[model samples]
Target: RALAQRQARDERADAARLYGRIATAHTYAGRYGEAQRGWRAAAAGHRKNGDVAAAARALSELARVQEYAGRPEESLRTCQEAVEWAKRADDIRLQAALQLRLADTLEHLDDPEAARLHRAAAERILEEEPGDRDPEPEHGANACEIRSAPAEG
Candidate 1:
């Protein structure tokens, strides 16, 4: 929290990272509202820093928070925005992950067919990559719903 305050004051890229951590902590602590706010801040910071990928990631996290808060429609919209950003950033992996998240949101919104389509799209992306397989079959045919831990820098 203190790191977030310091980073916010400095208005640096590190601020976005701190906000992401803070949001994750909030989510783990069951503070959905705070988590949403933190994710929004992180997204804004990433955008300001010209880091489209990070902004999309923050938006993805925001969508998850919205889903947790029972706002499937909002979550779906956020996921769409994240997808767009990922495409703009040319990050195929992130785009595929966001597509899966969108699929989950669509399922929550009672659009099973659309959800299935998204799962298929994500699967296709993974299949096109060499040596990539469904790491967790328990998560279903795509394992698209699995939340991967953030990569360490």
Candidate 2:
């Protein structure tokens, strides 16, 4: 956290990335409040720095943190916002992943129909990929794998 704050004084984008790493650590430690604050700052900083894709990724993780904190309503809203950012970033894979995540949150909220729709949308997105497109890397199958930072010693 101190490192991220220090970086914030000079490099907004780098600070956002550092905050994201701290947020991931907080999430693993079950420190939901700190995790939420870190992720929100990461998302905001990324957005302000004109890194929409990074902001989308941060928002996606924030939604997961919200869900883990038992705030499904907030999770749903955050997921929706993440989806929009992903779209703006022109990252189809991330958008599809966010949709699937939104589906999971909907299911947790007892909205199975909505969940099903989101699942179908995600499937459709994947299916719509052109045959010539490059295949996703082995780890790319999981959205969380896309942005998760390596654990620091």
Candidate 3:
């Protein structure tokens, strides 16, 4: 893995892609922190390489890992950043992906309004997207309905 990373660094575009692969592997290995760090590096590299869409894609994956690690708030922040990056890149596909991520995170955080907003955004974007698309598959389905946030204890 170290050798792969070194070789990846020799080429900027390849380095960004390798960092994403390494980060995914780290996530599979149950190293959330390491994966998050690697994803951050990948995001930075993508942004520097003028691939804002790719950067947003990395951030979306990082947010997914964060959500799996039980950090909903952090995941939301990361997803929001990814959404902004995607919008800046004018990549509708990436924007829809990020919206779904944010929606899933918000759903877990008990922010039904925000989650619904993102869900609608995702649906709208997916409607215009070419080819077959399923938003639910891309974004995890919610365990609870989006009625409203329950009262705090």
Candidate 4:
């Protein structure tokens, strides 16, 4: 009761995130229908809030759930829509990410040729993105420590 009241009071935008969280929980709980509905709701809410990234992310989640539910064709379509939303957001990294995902889903949908094309597109973007950008060195390294006993006199 108290928890429900608190949930009801959550900000609408934040509630979108909550819906995605609940979707994940429901999937883990083996509640396929509930998980999917939650993900769809999250996508809708984030879209309404003008958060293209969040909306695409939720659609991607929904795609994954549809795959888990044994609807690979639907998953493929859903993943393609996710990629579309990602493109609308103009996020290159997200584009590469979702292109890869949608490509894989197409593979499962028995469209290997389309999958290859999508994969090539993603690879082209990733390859072209770094041509002018300088690469950064790795941030951390493994250091070795040595202990020496006092030298014998």
Each prediction's Cα lDDT score? 0.81, 0.83, 0.77, 0.75
Q: How many residue pairs clash in each candidate?
A: 0, 0, 0, 0
| Alpha-carbon shift of residue 35 in model 3 (angstroms) | 0.4
What stretches of model 2 exceed 4 Å from their correct place? Answer: 1-9, 131-138, 141-153
RMSD score of candidate 4 (Å): 13.0
RMSD of each: 6.5, 5.4, 6.3, 13.0
CA error at residue 110 for candidate 2, angstroms:
0.8
Candidate 1 residue lDDT tens string, 82-139: 8998888877677788878887778777798998999999878767766655565345
Error of 1 at 134 (Å): 9.6
Among these predicted structures, which one has the highest lDDT? 2
lDDT leaderboard ranking: 2, 1, 3, 4
Ten-residue region with minimum lDDT total, candidate 1: 143-152
- Write the residue-wise lDDT of candidate 3 on 7-54 in tens digits: 655777888888899898999998999999889989998998999888
Pick by TM-score: 1 or 4, better one: 1
Clashing pairs in 1: none
Which lDDT tens digits does candidate 4 get at residues 1-153? 432554688667877888888899998897989999999999998998899978888888898888878887887788788878888987666676677777777777678899799889976765766434323212213111111112234
lDDT at position 120, candidate 4: 93
